[model samples]
Target: LEWAGDEFPWVLEHHSNLEPETQTWHSKLVTENWDSPIIFTSMVQFLEVLFGGGSRGARRMHNIANSVLIFDEIQSLPVNCVHLFCNAIQFFVDHARSTTLLCTATQPLLDNLKFPDKGQLTLPDDRELVGNMTEVFEQFKRVEIKNLVRPKGWSEQKLIELMITQLKEKGNCLVIVNTKKWAKKLYDRCINSVDADSLFHLSTSLCPVHRKEVFNTVRQRLDDELPVLCISTQLIEAGVDVDFNSVIRFLAGLDSIAQAAGRCNRNGNLDMAQVYVVNPQDEAIDMLPDIKEGREKALRIFSEKDETELLDPEVMSLYFSYYFYERANLMSYPLTEKQAGRKDSLLSLLSDNHLNIGIEKNAIKLQQSFKTAGKAFKAIDSPTQAVIVPYGDKGKEIIAGLCADFEPAKAFKLLKEAQKYSVNVFPNVWRKLIDAEAVKPVQKGEGIYFLEERFYSENFGLSTEVVSKMDTKIS
Candidate 1:
């Protein structure tokens, strides 16, 4: 909205349809005409329509039949959905005649995916969209990665000092950490050391509105050539377009490192930018299995090759190939159950007519378990529930509107606006808040929750500190 201005006919279609314009555009996109030339939607929405059991989903399938489908950040696709997703893509290309593009800095080996009875999902003519991809990688190389990980990781104080030093040496700096807890802690320490305006923080905990405001301020400062420091989680690693003179990243996947590098000297304006990879002492590697595995594989690659090889296309291909090989079983939706010991996957349920047939006294009848399979397909492993936090005046207004008796449409509008003030919390933390009466259900059995003012902080949207302290007091 900031780049193209509000007048531009565009829509952001995610869970948060906060704007009426966006809501209108989304409604239009799912309709028969699908009049919107440009439409943005989540992967869940895309998959749901393909495998979802409903008349609405059927209608959406028809609407998307011949549309040009583009999947960005293709690496982020869940491993469990790889087979199901690949099968859907093949269906789109062969049956629907749709043009599909999977764009990512670190492209997975989709051709290696094996489908039941369908064989490997192969691209037509096995052609490359961009010939000589190595040349493209070399041309885009603007930053040099410096490995700072050691046996003993750097302390929080040491990390903060290093960041301050970088800010002084470099005009602007960005620090990407592994977790929100670390990001907030580093931000607090950095805020004390630097000017309030120069220091910034970004995390999933903050509402979309708050994050947008922070991004706008950071951009303005960067444009003006002022001192700016942003401490963020992996949220800023992809899709976000911002350039910093120097970047400090915690040890993660090589693809994640590449994405982080893309943020530094992004436009090739700088002569050479620096990207530092450090291992933080405070973070627990065991808590994050994916990062641990990626780090292990990345470290092995680094041992074999030079640091500059990090940006090489062949090296990236090797990293992805190794990464996928480690979790090969996950490529197939293994968690999905079978019917009467009959091997069945979401792909089979959606695509195979024989699997959908059941014999009743020698009579074949259609019996596809679309709803059951759809319910099991989760893009993210640990699903989060959204809770509206009392952040500012707009948040208060949304809460007041929700409490009052309004029409269903008006209530939905309020809910959308509330999305900007919402924080996604795990079920355990949500239960703790509920027990403490710090939050209330927006509606019974609706899954929507609301946080009271006391539990919220202006600095941090939803304050876990308040919840913890309250729990202590109660105990």
Candidate 2:
């Protein structure tokens, strides 16, 4: 029940019209069987259960014990909670008897930091596991990073003007900006200036299924060599695999820049494509260390010479070297047992052998977690109803196969297994839901989606605070 767009059965059940039996069974399977086995949820879901509030959340709370948990985009965890989050994770893996997997293309430098030696779990060396990611990145080099440095300022107009040329020539391009507002602004400009069908708006505004639909459509166009233009926030920076002939990135961190580069000519078909690093007016992205540190690191390295030379990996390595060095510091913190907070941290919640000692107490704790989950779910975009888009013959067959040994928690897994047939909300849609807020328009703007502040508050589950403290550094 910690449901979101990417979790399909939940989405199907939440957004699609479904039979009563299917819906009842889905609820029972998720709520009653807390220890059913594998659970597929997002980083936000897991974090909310641990630190925030809901009812279905508590139902699945105790189940964290004695299972393997995987967190996608672990780096996206809020910065302030990194220590607490990682420590809790360490407790779960070592003491609570659960194993965890941090899945992402760009691994956050979590395991490298210091924590209690007693509770530490072994994580693979991401650098080695990825084995010279830079080398692999070179082979996949479909892009060349271009610097668009102009003291006059880079306007949305200028960005779209250049992108229009790329779209007409190559028929596909992706533009990534630091925020949703900028993405919307650019997306509107493109649509108004060019063929609307050829231009696509992608953001966290749409649900996951909606985003997935858009992504699939875009992918098909790329495959068919049809004209397509997409404007999006940095959410699509990692994991998403579609590539374009060119990518124009608003100036941000080096890691973000590298992530933007990863999206271009990723199939290695074409020679190097172009990735323009341009500075956009009216926003400072380098507000956080992750944002500021990399760009600043790149700037410091290039201060004695030309900025354009910094795009080469040999030169860019300095950016990451300095960037990770600072990131490592952010990861460093001392943890005492008292700071562990949860009583479960002291007593293993998973062990059946210890069950006799605090059975009632644990029940109460689980109930609390569920209550919190319910509260939190309401704040974020929770599924109000399930959606049932008719599946083609292949999709029906795939769904039939999953129904054979179906577990409700495996809804997303089954949907993913059936990717050949169906489409759920892609990840970016949820990102938009989580990021964009409904606010009244302060200025007259075309193609702009105005949102109310209450909607923004609700979209973030009314939990996370809006952060505007971006780094003011130039270059």
Candidate 3:
């Protein structure tokens, strides 16, 4: 549903999960090559084409030249890939001639970003759209962020109770948790207090199509001023449109806190909205060091007794200064040398090999490790494989199509359609499902998988709980 009545020509730069050919000209693009005159794309897609070594993404790299690139939340840039991201951006601007724009309430100090290698986001003084950000930020004030994060973190019951309390003052409430497991746990508790119809659970466990369905229902319910409660992971923080009178966000980065505020009082019907920062006791972010560090910085801001607003531009600057200084060594995409048994990084391999360990005058091949760096690079730490879930009759039909005899054209169309019902599972979870025979590939060597119907939940969407419980039963 796009309306460009008298505006410029527009097309979304995306692969699967697109509309049919008849819907718009965007779908007719050949293999998502990103050749549109006016293109809208995700940050991940831009980064992939910028740094990724894949031929598919490289084919679209030239399209970014002489075009505009907007990074909605520039602060959300990965800590380790800071230098890689900046250096690539410099290349695009200086070499390819592209215009870059950043739109973030909590902009990170990219200029101060320094590593051993020379990859810094150095910008001129006249680059700022607004000279005085602190004053400008005050004008956009819509939500009051309240720091209620305790030392030991809020218990599951305490968070639910807080939501119940907010319901009295506000009609709709949103609880953003850190992990999907915690979201599901809190959602189960929320259903007991609110009606099952009004309670919604959102996470990566559900496919994009399923999430869209939930979004439509939630938005409609909010419009009617009906009592609505949604427990979601950080996925709903950005780019989601639905709003609530009160928002309870799990304590995270300052940028994340700013983003959560956008979901509250969005239309500004209320005088002022409130966003509560709550830390869950059961939350564990060991694999997520970036989030852990961001949470610690946010805790520092919480300890301040000043009357400054949560998204005060000055406060945001302090948070990033602390965060970047703490993670100074990781800005260069750190990696280890496989052969040299020494500390190295992906950026160094791609750059002018300053710490050359394996270079000899008579070397047969170059030790730049260009291919190694490309193969090693990953946008997301946890690489997930999409699994088709039985979300509805449409999902079932897509699964049937995937299992049918091989035909490239037909398979491509079916795969595109299946994107709606596909849930991306991490490697560990995928392995567990495979071990329990809860999932299997639809076509061998094709890499497309289908999950057993019992493993997919109407409430939880997808989980390994059924497989684990069945194993215990067998034992």
Candidate 4:
């Protein structure tokens, strides 16, 4: 739910009934509404409320009052504030306010922090949590990790050639890299090299609505066993669910490697689906702040201890333990600065489930909270224009006749193979389109795309420059 909140504006606006200003505010309301059995929110949203900055951040501070809050990608939290984040969770759990579960293949040594001189939540023994986590992973054999750490040899072309050969028979493949530019470059190369019916591209470059359309289409194609190929960044690595029969990852950190593996044969249907961990030559890590830090820590782990045992769960724990400790000092606990003075905020939030009951109670408290409506996002608005690219002479005529009232459903049907058009959206138009299934989400690697009716117009949002008219029309 919180994933959609963080990523999809439509989900956040409608489901949470939040205006633009209140989007981040709704993460707190997840537990207040308490409708679902599970909620997947980011580390920032979870920890921000505990630290308490403003009214919106404070809303969820009380929502997690009495429930299980699982922090996914716990290692991704900024380094200097690990003590502050962990201490907050400790307080909630220690006081019986909530059951806290930390989920990550790599566990940071959380005991390194010194909280207030008094009133800290005592944690469960680290040994037991680590043991249970390992056991759970072993039981779930959907993901199999293969470690291939070679210092040299292998160009991007060679990797793409190998993947095209493999994907021809496998039907679906995912290639994950470290950056958007590289993902785009690899996607273009794969599209040019591979003999596939459909090629998809995904990255964080596409807004959330655009990304969702691409993801949904790729997922449907995979389920139908259709020929599809994608290249993307690590955005799809963690919680995004479409599994490919094969996955190729450019190596960096052990945790990321594990996440890349999770996207392969995730249902455990194939007896032996392959996950290749290769080192990309000419790969730039300077743009990747977390990856750079994680790689440095992983190198230290490999050199001083456990060379053969690298990426092993135990080895990963130590790797993150060192990584977070160093990272925390770099940022100097920017989000956790309030930890010193606001001892009572945590205490008051944890004080009572008496506030948990009654819709009236929640309604009254929410009313008392500040209200902030959202600004209109230009990417999403009504009556937004789309482009019709005529790849050939015939395609040009088909697009030239387009009018505002022309049938969108039929116009989309004609542009299937021609130079494709870019569909633009008005505020909330995408939410309507998605609900009506007028537009479908297609996922390639980590980039999302959609196919919708082609409209002819010179004006558009940021998508205008991307639209090109093709010389030929299917008609």
How should the candidates be ordered by TM-score, best one leading? Answer: 3, 1, 2, 4
Q: Any runs in candidate 1 off by more than 4 Å, and if so which?
A: 1-12, 16-38, 44-63, 114-121, 125-129, 336-368, 467-475
Global Cα RMSD, each model: 6.0, 12.2, 6.2, 12.6
lDDT of 3 by residue, 1-475 (tens): 3475523325543523222212222223324566657666566656666666556567788888887878877777888888888888888788888888877767788777645346876688887888877776677787998888787878878888998888767888998888888888887677668877778888989877778788888899899999888889988976689889999998888878888998998888988889998888868898888889999988887777353556888788888888898889888778775532467887787876567655454254554766667777777776566688877788899898878876656665566567677877788998888888888777665455788888877667787856222211100
lDDT of 2 at 112: 47
The TM-score that candidate 1 achieves is 0.82
Q: Candidate 1, after superposition: displacement of residue 305 in Å?
A: 1.4
Whose TM-score is higher: candidate 1's or candidate 2's? 1
lDDT of 2: 0.53
Q: TM-score, each model?
A: 0.82, 0.60, 0.86, 0.58
lDDT (10s digit) by residue, model 1, range 1-475: 3354343334434443222211233333323223345556667557656654444456556756787998888877776677777777887889998888988888877787433444345676755788888988888789988989888989988998999999999989999988888888998787679987788878877777877777887888898999998999998976888999999999988988988998999888888898999998868768676788788888878787798888788998888878877776666665433432356555555544345444543243544556666565555565566778776678888887776754565675566467578777776776788777888755444445678877865455576546332321100
lDDT of each: 0.72, 0.53, 0.75, 0.53
lDDT of 4 by residue, 285-399 (tens): 7846778777666557657764335545677777766765555444323212233222222222333323233455664344221111111111111224232233234434544
Q: What is model 3's C-alpha RMSD?
A: 6.2
Residues 254-336, model 2: lDDT tens digits: 66777888788888778668887887776655434455555566556646445444445555555545655555434322223
The collision pairs in model 3 are none
